[model samples]
Target: MSAEDATQGLGIDALLERERAKLDRLTPARAAAAVELQGALLVDIRYAALRERDGLIPGALVVERNELEWRMDPTGDHRAAETTDHDRLVVVVCNEGYASSLAARSLHALGLHRATDVIGGFQAWAAAGLPVTGAPNAPDGRA
Candidate 1:
C-alpha cells in the first residue's frame, strides 16, 4: 500500500499517539538547553531533499529515517560502532515533529532512553527565532 493508504482511516492524532507511547518529547527550548548543557546529540531525520530544500541545523547529525535505529543501538549488529559509548543524550528531528517523535522512541528502545524530539521540529525552532544554519535555499533566512 502507498504511504498515505497505509495511514488511511487513522488520523494524524492517532499516529502521533502511537508514536508518543514509545518516545520522549521535548520542546525547542528544552532541546536547545540540552544541546548546550548536556551535550545531547541532535539527529536530523529529514530526507536529503528536504535538507537541500531547507538548510539543516549547523551541528545536527544526519541519520536519515531508515538508518536511525541501526545507528543508535550499541548492541545491535547494525549499530554504528561510534555509539558504543551510549551514555549520551540523543534528540531526533524531522521536517516537522511527527516522524521524529516515533524515531526518538525507537532510539529509546535501543537504549538511548534520553532520546526525544523537538516539539515543533525545525520549523518551531526557526519560528522561535532560535539560531540555525545550512538552509541555503530557505526563504526568509530561516530553516
Candidate 2:
C-alpha cells in the first residue's frame, strides 16, 4: 500500500491510541521516582507559555518539541548532557500528555528504545503533589 493508503482511515485519536500502546507510559509518581532514583531522564517538551504558566519539574530537561529529536538523540551532535545513550530511560512530558506520546515514538524511531511519556503529563505531575518550581500561578502556589 502507498503511504497515504496506509493511513487513509486513521484519524488523530486513533493514531494517538496506537502510539500510546507501544509505550510503557508512566504515572506521575512513578515518573518522579524514576527520575529521582532510577536515573531516568524526565524531558519537558511543553512550549514556553505553558511551561511558564504551569511551572516546571525540578530537574526535567526543557527541550522544545521541534528540537526534541536532535537534542535527545544520543548519537547526535546536538544531544543534551543527559542524552547519554540509547538505553537511557527517557520520559517525555507535554502540557497534558498527548504530544509526549508522539514525541516518545519519534525518539524510538531514532533508536532510543527506552523512550516513553508520562500518562497525564505536567498537569498530572502538579496534581500529584510532585515538586514544581516557578509556578506562582499554580492553584496552590507551589512555587
Candidate 3:
C-alpha cells in the first residue's frame, strides 16, 4: 500500500500514540541513569537548529534524525562506534519527545529491540537538573 493509503485516517497524534505503545518510554532522570549506570547510548535526534538554540545533553550522541538508522544500525557500515550490538540500549531524545517515539520505533524495526525515547525529551532532561551544554545558565553554572 502507498504511504498515504496506509495512513489514510491516522493523524500525527494517533501515529505517535501507536509508535509509543511499542516502547517502554523513559523519563529524563531514568534516562540519565540508564546512560550513567547501564551503558545506554543516549542519542539526540533534534535538528541542528534546535541543538544550537537549546543547547545539548553532554555526551549524548548527536545524530541527525535522517541519519539515525544508518548511524545506529549495529551491522551497518556507517554505524557509529557506539552501535556495537543489537542488545545495546538506545535512548532517543527529540525536542519535545514526540519525534523520538517515532524514531525509537524505527530503531526497533532495525532490530534494536531495546530502543526507547525520553518522555519529555531534552526539555525534561534539563528541567530534571540533568547536564546540558550551551543552554542559558547551564548545569555547570555557565551563562
Candidate 4:
C-alpha cells in the first residue's frame, strides 16, 4: 500500500471498490447473453496455468491481463482485430473477477464507453451453465 494518498492510504480493496464503482459489471449469465444478443466481446485475462487448470469460456478472447489495454486500444499497433469499434461492449474476465474490473476501467480510458467486466468471472459462468471448453493441460485453449 502507498502512503500519503487521497484515499487515506487504503489498499487493494479500496482500489477495487473505486474501479468497480466506475463500471456496470454483469453477472455471468447476462454476460453470456450479452455476447450472443448485445454483441459484447468477452475477454479472458487469466494466466496460462490457471486457464489450463480451470478451462476457458468458449468464445472469449484470450489476452493476458498485463497487455489488455494495449490489445484493446484501437490506436495501438497491436490492438486486436475485434476491438476496432469504440462502441463495442467489452466484457473482461479474470479468474475470480477482481482484475477484470481494473482491466475494464483501462479500456474505458481509451474511449471504450461500453467496457465492463464479468461479475464473478469464468467460475460464475461455469456455475451458471454457460459453455466452456478445454481442461487442465488439455491443449485446446490458447497458451
Candidate 5:
C-alpha cells in the first residue's frame, strides 16, 4: 500500500491486536525491572520530533524505528559499527506502542531472542510516573 493508504486509520484496537500478536510486550513496571536488572537495552524508536515534544527516558538508546533491525543484529554486516554484541536484551519504544512492537519483532526475527517492546510505549511509561530526564531538544533532529 502507498504510505497514505497504509496510515489511513486502522482502528486502535485492530492496531493493538496486530502488535500484541507479533511482539512480546512489557508493562512499565516490568520494563522498570528489566532496566534495574540491566537485562534490557531500552531502545527509543520515536522520531526525534516526538521525543522533543515529549520527554525522553534517561539512558534509552536512540535507535530510529527504520534502522532497528540493522542496528540490533551483530551477525549481520549491516549492523551498526558501534554494536559489537548480539546477545543483549532489547526493549523498543515508540510514540504509542505499534511501531516499536513491529521493530521489536523484527529484531527477534534477526535472532535477538530477548527483544520486546514496552506495552504502552513512552506515553504509558511517562504516565506511570517513571523516571524521565533530558531537555526537550537535547537530542535534536529526527532519525
Candidate 6:
C-alpha cells in the first residue's frame, strides 16, 4: 500500500476522538441558549449538499468546513463580519458532531478562545426543537 493508505492507520474514529479531546463541546440546548442569550455566533460547516438535503438552523452562519479557519479568523480579511470580535463565543455545527469539533479547534487556534461545537451536531439541535429554516420539519423539528 502507498503512503495514503498507511495514513488511515489511525482510522477516522480515532482521529475524531483525538480532535474532540481538545474541545469543550456544548449540548444542543446549551448551544441554542448561547446564541440567544450570550450572543454566540453559530456556524454551520456542513457542505452545501447536506444543507440542501437536511436544511439549516435559523440564524446560523453557513460557512463550509474548508473555509472555516480563514473565514473565522478575526484578523483575516476573509473573516465574516461577526468574526471581528475574537472574544465572541462561536459554536460550530457539522452533519454529525465530528467535523465540528475539528472546526472549533481550528477556531481556537485562530485565537477564538470561546470556540466550541455542538455535542451531537445539527441532528441534536433539531431534536431539541430549535428553530430551523427550510426542510427541517416545522413545529416538531423532527428531521
Best by TM-score: 2
The local lDDT score (0 to 100) that residue 20 gets in candidate 4 is 95
Off-target runs (Cα >4 Å) in candidate 4 are 1-4, 136-143
lDDT by residue (tens digit), candidate 6, 1-143: 45975776767777678778887789999998999999999999999988887788988999999899989998998999888788999999998888899889888888998999999898888777777777744545446
Q: What TM-score would candidate 3 get against the native?
A: 0.90
Q: How well is each residue in 1-143 modelled by candidate 5, as lDDT tens digits?
A: 35764879766677657656866689988888897897577889898888778877877888887787777788877776545576777788898877877787777787777788898889888878786765454344211
Q: List the residue pairs that clash in candidate 1.
A: 55-134, 55-135
For model 1, residues 20-138, the per-residue Cα lDDT tens digits are 87665888888888988988888888899988877778778888899988777878787754465567888887888888987887777777877889988888877777777666855
Residue pairs clashing, model 4: none
Candidate 2 lDDT over residue span 16-69, tens digit each: 998999999999999988988999999999999988877988989999999999
Better of 2 and 6 by TM-score: 2
Looking at model 5, which ten-residue stretch has the lowest summed lDDT? 134-143
Backbone clashes (count) for model 5: 0
Using lDDT as the measure, which candidate wins?
2
Clashing pairs in 5: none
- Please provide TM-scores, in order, for all candidate models, with all chains considered together: 0.79, 0.92, 0.90, 0.88, 0.75, 0.85
Off by over 4 Å in 1: 1-12, 21-23, 76-84, 137-142
- For model 2, the superposed segments whose C-alpha errors exceed 4 Å read 1-9, 138-143
lDDT of 4 by residue, 1-143 (tens): 45566557667898889889999999998898899999899999999988878888887899999889889998889999988789989999998899899889989999999999998888787767677777654354422
Ranking by TM-score: 2, 3, 4, 6, 1, 5
**Which should have the higher TM-score, number 2 or number 3?**
2
Report the error of model 2 at residue 9, Å.
4.5
